[model samples]
Target: MPRSIATLLFLSVLAGATPVLAQPGGTPMQLPRTISVPGSGSVTGTPDKAQVRLTVQKTNPSMEKARAEAVVVVQRFLALTKKLGIPEAKVRTTSAMVNPEYRWDQPTSRQVLVGYSVQREFEVEVNDLDKLGALVEGAVDAGVNHVAPPVLDSTKRRELNRQALAAAARDAEANARAIADTLGVKLGSLRELTAGGAEPPRPPMPMAMMKATMAEAADAGGAATYTPGSLTFDATVNASFDIVSP
Candidate 1:
């Protein structure tokens, strides 16, 4: 109907004057009563693994020369990893691209083709944190010109998740009981349990180590230094508990 009538109806419902529809037998249908609560928990541990993405880029007037130079740089990086005793399985080339370089020319009022650029990117997974700094230094020394910030990881991620989930479950139960006690009602059997909203922890938190820029890596002279920090895993759970008269 009109807005005024709709508003009045809603206000009346809030005032506990809602109209109830009768069933086929003329009895009113009642909805099941439940209380849903949200809970969250977290656990922290040290990171024991890391990954680094390294890239080699070359640009030249000739596409052939650019491609050849990029290949040589990539080979050097791979050979260095091999010498370091890193397993072949943990290393893989991620991407390779060849594009024509263009420059905006003010005199010609048009884009001018300058050269060809060839780039190759690869990733290395390091199980030993002690070797992380050395690995990055070695790659840069081998002429790998670009280095992305390292991503620190934990070997016990599954265990941590389980612990966090347990904590979250307990938290949810506690919340339900507290609400029930406040409402002067008893909490009956669990109607539903849903786990969601938990995500893998991101980097740059306190004590977490993300490396410096490519220039900083090259200037370190010796093996680059890194401070492995603690990582926190979190979990959230939504629980529905039946409401019963006390």
Candidate 2:
């Protein structure tokens, strides 16, 4: 081939290679600046009702005797709650168990059957806070040995949750505005929003000593005093908004 022809061919190949080298880089593109923020809100309200776990336990030399005694104690407890004006629907049996007691003989390496113990538990719901202490005391007098502290709750929890969620939204909006100001950008309309479900209300710790004193007062026929503690509803929200340059 002639030298000029060969030179022209080489130049054509070089031109084609230049466009391939100019192709875009494989790295990811840069995105706009954005911020994520979380906000929390809470609302407090008085509990309307409360529930307690009460148990009657009895042990005797004979299984039959233990079962009978347990039944009597449970009956007395139910009667006492009824006398206190607690509705039957509000009081119900939760558990009943009869188990045999075992005694281990070290010398013989054998298990000896002693007797049976019977246990019965009831759940009680109280609408009046003032009567809470009295109710526990009354049951204790009626033979309840194991009594769990009362769990307080608001019957209108749905309403309380709604209020808390509204408050959380407002809080989230305020937080977004503050962030936008700090960034020297104008706050734009909300682009995305997410809400966490409300948490269940927590009950106050039951004072065992206080409960014993209340029981003693009830046994003496003296009025027992009780103050219902308030509960708080908490909610959280996550919101995103478009960021506009100033």
Candidate 3:
């Protein structure tokens, strides 16, 4: 090859390799400088709805009779709920079972089938929190001996979630700025951002049976008042920012 052709080939190779050494000092090139961190945020809200769980149990010599009695009790509960202005769509039967009671025979080493027992459970949602106490008392009066204390919640959870996400974004930005200040650098344009998935609302702790009994006693003396508790919502976010040296 001629000398001029060989020199031209060498220059082309050197030019191709120069980009590997070109870095941020020359101009604003994308170089990883910032660290990402997760920030958590939360908000509290008042409950506007309530849910109640109730069970009906009956025993009889025959399975059919036990099941029939359970049905009657459930029907009565439905009627009572309707009278209390609870919509039928909000009340539903969650479980029903009929099983034979068994007696263990030690001598024969066998299990004997005795009378049958039937159980029915229902889930009821109440939009009116003011009537919660009356609803419980009405169920008890209607022969529902196994009624769980109602769970209170807000119907406007979507709005609460929105607010929580906004707060979380603000928290993430603040955290990023604090980190940048500590490192003695300026926070540049956002590189990446992601939001944590929304979690299901946590259920409140059940009030103890003793507390309910006491509340009932208080009700007998005069009008009883219940203080509906607040609910908390949480959000999380991960953010990355470009770091610029001062």
The digit string of per-residue lDDT tens for model 3 on 154-226 reads 8878888778888888888899888767655677787888988465375643567525644775668632345
Pick the TM-score winner: 2
Give TM-scores for every candidate, taking all chains together and pairing residue i with residue i.
0.79, 0.82, 0.79
Residue 9 error, candidate 2, Å: 47
Report RMSD (Å) for each prediction in the order shown: 5.2, 12.2, 9.6
Error of 2 at 103 (Å): 0.6
Please give the CA lDDT of all the candidate structures. Answer: 0.79, 0.77, 0.74
Quote the positional error of residue 38 for candidate 2 in Å.
0.5
Superposed Cα deviation of residue 7, candidate 2 (Å)? 48
Model 3 bad stretches (over 4 Å): 1-30, 197-201, 209-225
Write out the backbone clash pairs for model 1. Answer: none
Q: Following a full C-alpha superposition, what root-mean-square deviation does model 3 have from the true structure?
A: 9.6
lDDT of 1 by residue, 1-246 (tens): 668755754454334343344579999854445768988888998998988888899999999999999888888888888887889999998998999999999998999999999999898998987777777777777888877777888989989888899889889999999987776667889999998646557463222243453246557555666777788999999998877643
State the weakest 10-residue window (summed lDDT) of model 1.
205-214
lDDT of candidate 2 over 123-155, digit per residue (tens): 989898778877877777788888787888998
Q: In terms of lDDT, which candidate is strongest?
A: 1
Score residue 78 of candidate 3 by CA lDDT: 87
